[model samples]
Target: MVRFLWVCIVVAFCFSKWVDGFVQYSQRGDPKTEIINNTLMVSITLIRGAEAKGAVCLDGTLPAYYFNRGHGSGANSWVVHFQGGGWCSNITECVARTKTQFGSSRYMLPETGFTGILSFKAEENPDFFNWNRVLIPSCDGASYSGDSENKEAQLHFRGQRMWLTFMEELMSLGMRHAKRALISGCSAGGLTSILHCDKFRGLFKKSTKVKCLSDAGFFPDEVDISGEPTFRNFFSGVVSLQGVKKNLPRFCTRHLDPTSCFFPQNLISGIKTPLFILNSAYDIYQFYAILVPASTDPNGLWDNCKLNLTNCSPSQLQIMKGYRNQMLNLLKPISKSKQNGMSVTSCYAHCQAQYQVMWHADNSTLIGTKTISQSVGDWYFDRAEIKVYDEGCHYLVPQ
Candidate 1:
């Protein structure tokens, strides 16, 4: 217990205006041939975020190994995979740069990550099934970077800015490939799903592409973005940023703003975008940590209840709401509901030799064919281990 509390304290203390981390993955950014028998994957490096500095984080392309099993003139529905990082974070950058900075040290994505969502366990999911992953690049805090009192200012700004650019860039790429595409992210990235819904629609429609699938990025609704101290200013230091609020739209978020502001209503309402929200029974990290309930934009849910129901069947809405409710209650005062990392470690080896649980799933994308204006929303948690039961190889995904 002391150890667990210690880790939490460290995380909370580091909660500064904007704590940054970086990773550079060199996998091909392209899925493999065997996996190609499943789906086509294409990586649309958005080319935005932290660009104010003018220097591209890294020029080299990372390889993505996908498995495809669909038919198309290379024009199939695509899924844009985003990894988990609760915004204001650098987990992705850290992962991508593991080899460069750490060098084959104990930093590469361990085989365990592939074996299960949790680094060392396999109970939440039996077959670690996540595809189309991105080493979530660095985020931008825009101009709201001053007030140290309110940490969200920075987190919200960074998420809004980074996600908007991601959507636009993804839309531009989907324009020439699949019928539609999927947009997904975990933690803050999932939050990105709801916030950027509006902007994504306009761009996709303009290109005549498809809609988005927002996984568990939903937080009741946003109230007001304006807070006591804005995080934009604090973020300026990280991106070689310049100017003030006046520089916005024209210079700043022009490439960073999520569709939330311009659209008002969560984008889910405006367009008939299909979204698949998945969350864990113990996803308190997002619920308790990120959700500033009173502050979430109210109009955010404006689009959800009306106008967009034709496609969002009752079943879909029910499923989404159910998980969201579970999310709400569990996160009210969010604490690590999942088993503690320490508990997972063997206590100097149990008296008897006990087998540990390992859950995993594999996914692949094939961009072998090309279509235009498409997307797939398949964002989900890396895996939130609610309770570390010794369950083995069970299919958690619905069949």
Candidate 2:
């Protein structure tokens, strides 16, 4: 059944602009009603603080977010999600991103219907339907970590300041009194969640229940098919360019290079806060963007396979299988954390928690009888014990 759905998804990937649509830029694209329900008025809050002095987007626009106040019993509870867009490692890439939604508030949508964990409907988001939800927009072109300002490039790489100011603003808005809090993100945003989990917990009282979730964010620091140090080189540039070494967790930086610290595999074991990692063994973005980037495949050996998985040769699939094994192996030690939770399944999709269809459906992405929504909800609410680490072939589900 999963295989059949995978075939359909591969067809869609081949026929449609799947890569463009799923890129972090769309801010978690889910099916939207043509008119965009007028009742859902999401006002944008611009940045403000001493740290935000030069904390602007790549396009020189102020960062913003959508805040939905909770009602009834959920007023004291909070759920904050950091938006995800791929990072820019160089001045050239950041300049290009400035023209797009990832780096410019001018391109962000004024009105967006919340779905997945942000869904107002109780059926779609049972645990957090009424929680005070905050969506932190991604426009820094970094994973919300950087403090350098480039006057010549006309860019303010102050993602760290932006994150600090954003959190401070949330605390001023009554989040300091939160009884239960969850910080989550997808893709680049997911990395942000992992990076700031302990800092977020520190903001609240010890009695407060604070946790984090990273969706499709466990990027492995491994070599691409071409055996080149693609991500290392890219991250090395980003770290040096953005002055990110000082911003990283000191414990990690003390042991490893700043670029290596960015990888979850190197940083996960040191995290003291409770965390939940939701990732696909065969993450679509990593496969194309990192594993076999255009630079690694100048001849386009993976062009057909990337667009349509069904077209992949046996050797290509073998490499992908190896990638899956690496993910599982990296996760082995983190699995022992009693406070941590995970759902590392064999799927080709990215950002599972953002879409309504993938979060929970009749044929939703799952490990055994548990769907992503069910497992995450249980972990968050402490309703049930969750230890899901499925050892099987990757599965695909059509949206």
Candidate 3:
């Protein structure tokens, strides 16, 4: 699965706009760097005084983010993006993550390239290219919402604290004065955007145009091929292990279990802030982890089919179609809301907004005539009420 994910990324990069430029590095306090080709490599900024606030990662390392200040018309506009990595549900899994960048800042690269929505090049990210872009790394192992600790394992599940600290730091850095602001994320980070959408709106004045974009964040509450609630069971473990129940939306938890509330399907309707959802109808992560997990297919019935959609048998294709319909059905309420927007295509992929090719390249995935970037821009600016859903499946093998 890891190899297949890299293949998808490499294929996306192949279709992306690449230019020639010099590589430059900056000192600690300075976060911005010149755009090298289409990618803007930004330095990481560890949250100041995070230890005092107990805002730490799984390994108790300080939380960090990469920032690039906006200029021109977008200077006052801010885009705070939550980084996405799969979550660790159990103590064993969490401990394992502590040794990697996902759970510890100690393992993170000093700097990372910002492409897709975070790109500085207007040609690559036309709408908000000049806006202040911030990428908060996913080191807490819980989509920035957990708030507990495991003393036995020496782990700190302080995702909620990390989120607060990061927001406070960004506000101090000038987000408080923003005329417009957007909070976005992909995968788990996408889930973070949904979970915090209204809270993010509360941070700004009523006049401030604050909105949220969740890319591939809608993890559905569905049964696996073996008729087991795999995702639900996994989420229950995460919520119980990390104490995520307290951070969940009250509107949802009031009636549903904390585990159910964790799924975006149960939380989207109550969000008062304008929200845009960008997801593929057949999200590959769901196909791999939820619908047909290795445990469920002990004989590896889906090994090849999961890696490539075209390799699926007729029955497998039927199951996939059912999954797609289920996702659309779950999104029905948002589809009717004028304040909300969506661009759910029948692509066999996940996390589109963070890739330059899928975001706005000439051959980018499209819903009707608009690329993901264009559709998102139209919604954010109120230029259009975008609600695009593709009827046909678009299958491609990574090469």
Candidate 4:
């Protein structure tokens, strides 16, 4: 227990931001990719309770952010992106993460290139390039929800505090006067976006247009192929160990378990703010962590299948198809929601918008012939009624 608590403190201390931890594509910021360099990284100036509450990373560093000022008519618009990486459920993983870019700011680059939703070039990011943009690094092992504070344990699970401090700083930088605002994140960051969507909307006046977008964040709470609830168990551990119950949405806690509220399926229905869900029905992360976790496949029965979808046997493919169906089943409620819009495709990948090719390129994956960027732009501006886009694997762009 002592070692685990120490690991937790180290993880929090060394925490840094990641662009998109699970991106499969590379060569970002190239002309072909259309992800240009536009934003500059800036370390946070004021950290509320940093000294007393220990809201510091493993290296005793503060959170770093990348911000770009808007110009022309976009001067009043703001978009904040929360960086994403997977979460650490145990001490070993958390301790190890603090040493890598995902957990420790010490190893992070002083500057990071902004692509996808953060793209500043009008040609590439057609709709939102000029909006005042901020990219927040998430080093908290708890998806910015943990609040456990035990000095004897030598742990500081203050993800909730960190988020509040970061938001306060951004608001001071001019988010409070924004005409329009959008909060988005990918993977674990995607989950954070969902959890904080309503709170973000409340930050501004009702007259201000506020919404949320989540990329590859709609993680389901279904049993894996092995008939085990791997993700649920993992979330239970996160909630219990980090004391995440206090940070969960009150509406959800009134009826459901705190860990259950962490999942988007249960959380979204309760959010008052409008939201857009951009995810793959066959999310690659779910394939690895939820569907066939290492704990369930201890003998490595799913080794090849997890690495390469093409290597799966006929029966395994059938199982994957069922999993996709389950995702659609889970999404049925949100599809009917008037306040929510979705672009869930059947691609066997995760975090598509982080790459320029998938965001708005000629060869970008399409949902009803519209690229992810086009769809999100149209939805954000209320250009048209955005509905859920799910055409199955046949419509998936060749990865």
Give the better candidate number (1 or 4) by lDDT. 4
The top-ranked prediction according to TM-score is 3
| Per-residue lDDT of model 2, residues 21-55, tens digit only | 33211223222222244223355666654333766
**Model 4: lDDT to the true structure:** 0.76
Candidate 1 residue-wise lDDT, 133-194, digit = tens: 22333232221211111232211123333344444444443433445544544444454443
Off by over 4 Å in 4: 1-54, 58-60, 150-153, 392-399
RMSD of 3: 9.8
- Report lDDT (CA) for all predictions: 0.30, 0.80, 0.88, 0.76
lDDT of 3 by residue, 284-364 (tens): 888888899888998888888877888989999999899998999999988999999999987788788888888888788
Highest lDDT: give the candidate number: 3
Give the per-residue lDDT digits (tens) of candidate 4, residues 98-189.
77766666666665677778777677789887787777777767888887644543445667877887788778777899999999998998
Give all TM-scores, in the order shown: 0.36, 0.87, 0.92, 0.85
Poorly placed runs, candidate 1 (over 4 Å): 1-74, 89-175, 205-209, 220-272, 280-282, 286-399
Instruction: Report residue 142 deviation for candidate 3 (angstroms).
Output: 1.4
> 1 or 3, which is superior by TM-score?
3
- Collision count for each candidate, in order: 96, 0, 0, 10
How well does candidate 1 match the true structure in TM-score terms? 0.36
